[model samples]
Target: MEVKKAIIPVAGLGTRFLPATKSMPKEMLPIIDKPVIHFVVEEALASGIDDIIFVTGRSKRSIEDYFDGSPELEMHLKQHKKHDLLEKVQDIASLADIHYIRQKEPKGLGDAILRAEKHVGDEPFAVLLGDDIVVNEQPCTRQLIDIYQKYGRSTIAVKEVPKEKISSYGIIKGKPLDHSLYVLEDIVEKPDVDKAPSNIGAIGRYVFTPEIFNCIKETSSGVGNEIQLTDGIRNLNRSQKVYGYKFNGTRYDTGDKVEYVKAIINFALNNENMKDNILEYLQDVLASKNNA
Candidate 1:
């Protein structure tokens, strides 16, 4: 009940990052210097969720000008005094309370989260998928918003994917109530490793339960014809119970170009100003490929 709105959905047309997302908006593609949707809106503002709701489309206006408010790059960093880079560009326009809508075409992701059903009316929201980054020390959307605030229902953030990548996602099958929880009965979308139903996939975080916008307006189109948020969470798990936690961790699908160059070499080897010059430039490119 306290999930103060989220719903990222950045209206995908990335076409697997073609032509540099042909005019930018692949969540403003970046990793080493922030902009994989700014670490997914800083993991929904570090999980207290300050009401975001992006759901955009059509070349995404440079993700609404990278969280707006630059004011001539803050008067050219205050006329070059650069007050610590103008307080980090005025703290990305005061970080939260953002809002956008669009989604007029490129349909999928359940019609871009049904364009935030009138700014998430019935609440209990949170979606997060800006091509997933999930680096977690507890903010994989706050570990499914703390299992949807101790079991009030719709939660999902699953992991364990390797049955040949379980046909690339939405797999859940459920039963175990706690070794990292799961209650779902079934959710298939993308299944095929001989009709998958178990290698537990479902990623890009979620929390749902605005009765999932009437189960995504009674889901219909699927597999590329679109409207498939895992078939509207399998019609909100046939009227109620749906859960899946498994989260703890290191997602980074970054819309894959080999996982976006391994999330830019794991965020430039955990950047403390580029970790020892990227670990001595990755040990001189692995000792010049082991002496060629």
Candidate 2:
């Protein structure tokens, strides 16, 4: 079956981004000119996803509004003859068929996904984490979706992190199903470097079958009393085939401060309008610091 729906879990309390995130969602934070979540939605749309289900929370109304039509702003732009700007605003709302469900509590990733069960009924769907932004020639989710079409099994996006950083991610131990695919055997959530199954770590993009809802219900809280998604996928692998794809891309964890700043600089330097000036200014700043 063609994958037409995508679920995005955006209910996390952005504790890492404190004070600033007190009133605003971290996903709304900008990387250059576009918000983090906008990039995520664009990725889903680029992969032919027709419907988007966002598992959101109370303060996330801004997210919904961001993708909705803004009549007053549209009228102002139209009257002022800013045709190009007006078209861009209208295009945002027309991107996809967006739906939202409130995740009442901060249960976990597994629970966040479960909230979308009704909307995604009986079909395979994709899940894209709002914090993990991948920039490449091709969208990251599209890469996973292409793999899903071939195997017709659940697939998780994987990437090689340093062995020392394995404990910070869900580590997987599996055999190669193909060059970029793995027949997942087991997944360890945050294992010590020495004990990690492999350097391949789950990076937040997933294409899962409907059977996951049952596995999630059977899974008990594995770490931090929070129901982990890795546990459910591991259980699903026991009976059904689950594969991991070592996706190709530069992924930025915008949820972290340092990486967020790096993403801003990298994106800014890549922009056609700003690239030359930004590069020259950066070189001057570096030269001044060296002389000082």
Candidate 3:
């Protein structure tokens, strides 16, 4: 079965970004000019995904509006002869067949994904977390989808984080299925440094079989009194095969304040319009700091 749908969970109340996110969705926060969520959607589109199900919440109306047609803005751009900008704005809505389901409460990732059950029906689907932005020569979700095609099972994207940082993510323990793949034995969510099973931490991309919905339905709430997607995936592992892929990419954890700022700086410095000026400004800041 070809994977044609993707679910993006963007309903989290980003408390980490406090005052800014208090009014705006963290997914709306810009990396440079484009919002972070746009990159996730762009990746899904690049990977041949036709339908996108955004599991969103109340304050995330901006996300919906961002992808919908901005008639007034488009008219203004057209009047100003800004053809390039107008096309860019118009392309957002044209990217995919976007559907939305409101996650009524701030539940866990599992709950967010479950919200898309009706939209997904019985098809295999991809899940991409809005908080993690992955930049690669090939899309991260595409990498997992390819693995799913080859193995005829679910696949999760993994990357080796520092041992000390393993406690921050769902750590996996598994032997190599090949150079870039692992047959996962178990997954430990937020394990302590000493208790961590392995340094291979789960990234944002996932390709899941339809059987996953069954596991999610039966899954009990784990930590934080919330249904964790990790727990559901672990349950799915028992009855079916779940593999992990060490995806090739640079993942930015935009949910973190420091990382968000770093992403802004990195993306800004790489922009065609701002690269030289931004690099010069950065060099000046560094030189002045040393002189001081």
TM-score rank order:
3, 2, 1
Worst 10 residues of 1 by lDDT: 25-34
TM-score of each: 0.34, 0.97, 0.97
Per-residue alpha-carbon lDDT of model 3 for 1-292, expressed as tens digits? 9999999999999999999999999999998789999999999999999999999999999999999999999999999999999999999879899999999998799989999998899999999999899988899999999999999999999999987678778999888978889998999888999888889999889999998988988888877788899998999999988999999988999998888888888888778899999999999999999999
- The alpha-carbon lDDT assigned to residue 247 of candidate 1 equals 85
Which TM-score value belongs to model 3? 0.97
Predicted candidate 2 versus true structure: per-residue lDDT over 1-292, tens digit per residue: 9999999999999989998999999999999778999999999999889899999999889999999999999999999999999999999999999999999988899999999999999999999998889988888999999989998999999999976678889999999977888999999988889989889999989999999999998999887788889999998999999999999899999998988999999999889999999999999999999999
* Tens-digit per-residue lDDT, 210-256, candidate 1: 98888878988888688889888888899889898888888888888
Ranked by lDDT, the better of candidates 2 and 3 is 2
Q: How much lDDT does each candidate structure score?
A: 0.86, 0.92, 0.92
Steric clash pairs (candidate 1): none
